[model samples]
Target: MKPEQLQASGRRTLEIERDAFAGLLERVDAHFAEACTLMLGCHGRVVVTGMGKSGHIGGKIAATLASTGTPAFFVHPGEASHGDLGMITPQDVVIAISYSGETAEVLTILPLIKRMATPLIAMTGKPASTLARIADVHLDVSVAKEACPLNLAPTASTTATLAMGDALAVALLEARGFTSEDFALSHPGGSLGRRLLLRIQDLMHTGDRLPRVAPGTPLTAALLEMTQKGLGMTAIVDADDRVVGVYTDGDLRRSLEDQIDLRSATIDQVMTRGGKNARPDWLAAEAVQLMEKHKITALLVTDDQLHLQGVIHMHDLLRAGVV
Candidate 1:
């Protein structure tokens, strides 16, 4: 086939899917709201079930719901007939998906699901099909046409189904007041979790690894501490171990320009007073933002009372993938 023909085929697929999505949006109505309400009010998990291609879409919907604060799981309709129906509880909400609303595997378990009296939400292209008639709520995810040229493949219909599932998940997420922190808890291993939930206390250098010295210590001694700790900076603390100021390589350069004798000058005289500081509980990503805003490489972690707790450097954040 010619390249132009291949391009035309791809364009046709996109146009079909786009129109299908537009149709879904136009069909959104009270049924969608009823489905959301049923799932939100459910005391137990949302049990999603489908057969064949619908099963794949149901699996993704379950995952999206679970991650977005709606507790949900997928059960294959075929398996449900073979005893997996036990997973469904009366307190739970059941979502059944079938483009035709008459998949044999799914329809076979409808009686058992009804016997349990679980709230049923049916997603189907046919609004007047048997499944829709029996379900407590019917969400119409109908598409005008299939993306495939032959009009037989599950293309545009599945896309519409998936988008509708996302709409439910996001709507429920907002209704539940789910925050970024809540999302981070569900995705602790991901980069977004690290950026939102990981704190300075979790990544900062603490205890002996923290570069610190008495305020009156010689500038030369503070430099040695900075070099030994490898943080490129040292916290100048008072007798009570409260940070009074900070000395960094930047201060050392300025002191040299002023021709101050490092061996004789005290840390209190050379240190930058009231330098940027963060709380141990502050998010590491926030600390990174602060550092970038001030164009500094290090920040002393302190408590509300200004007691030194730890030190965070750009290197530490970079190593932790917060940078």
Candidate 2:
């Protein structure tokens, strides 16, 4: 094919698939709500199964459901005919996917699923297909035509199925009040997880690692503490260990301009009083927002009493992949 022909083919495929996906918007009717209600009320896992291209789409649907708050897993229809049928229990809900809705592998297990009294949700293009007729809830993922020129491949059909699966997952997610933090619990291995799950106390420096000085400590001593702790700042605390002020490198620059004796001046005399602070329980991502709002790199972690518990820096957020 010529270059222009290849480009035209790709564009046509996208347009067809886009329309197929858009078609699902009108079909999100009472049946869709019923399917969501059944899955939400299920006491056990949502077992998803399909055949061929539909099987691939089923696996993705199962994964989205599992990650978003609904507990679900994919079981191959062919495997279900064997001992894997034991995996489905009466308390669970089963979701089966088939474009034709007459996949022999899927049909073979219907009698067993019915015997167990497990609720079956079928996703198919044909509303009157045997699987749809037998299922407790039927989701119509029908598309008018295939994106393939020969109209044989599963292009637009599979795309519509996947979009329908996503719609279900997101709707169920909202119904369950599933938050980002809840999602992070299931997806705790990546940067997205770190930003959502990580807390200030988890990454903040505490104890000896904290740079601090007595209120009347000399400017040189505070600078030394900042250098030793490598936090670019030192907290000045009262006798009760409550933070009274903060002295950073920026303060040091201003002190030098005033020609204040670094050896003679006290940290309290030059420190910025009442620094921006965050709670230890706050998310590290929240800390990033606070820092950006205040235009500061570090924040002192404290309790309701403003007693210093720890300190967090922008560099720490960067290393933790929360920045």
Model 2, stretches more than 4 Å misplaced?
Answer: 1-3
Q: How many steric clashes does model 1 contain?
A: 0
Question: Candidate 1, residues 1-323: lDDT per residue as tens digits?
Answer: 89999999999999988998888876678888989999989999999999989999999999999999999999999988999999999999999999999899999999988999999999999989999999999999988889987889999999999999999999999999999999999999888988998999998889999899996787778889999999899998888889889988898899999999877888988889979999998999999999999999999999998999999989988887776
Candidate 2's residue-wise lDDT over 1-323, tens digit each? 99999999999999999999889999999999999999999999999999999999999999999999999999998998988999999999999999999999999999999999999999999999999999999999999999998999999999999999999999999999999989999989988899999999999999999999998898888898999999999999898889899999888899999999888899988999989999999999999999999899999998999899999999999999898
Misplaced by over 4 Å in model 1 are: 256-260
Q: After TM-score superposition, what is the CA distance of residue 214 in candidate 2 from its true location, in Å?
A: 1.4
| Deviation from native of the Cα of residue 258 in model 1, angstroms | 5.0
**What is the C-alpha local distance difference test score of each model?**
0.92, 0.95
Q: What is the C-alpha RMSD of each candidate to the true structure, in Å?
A: 1.7, 1.6
Which pairs clash in model 1? none
The local lDDT score (0 to 100) that residue 68 gets in candidate 1 is 95
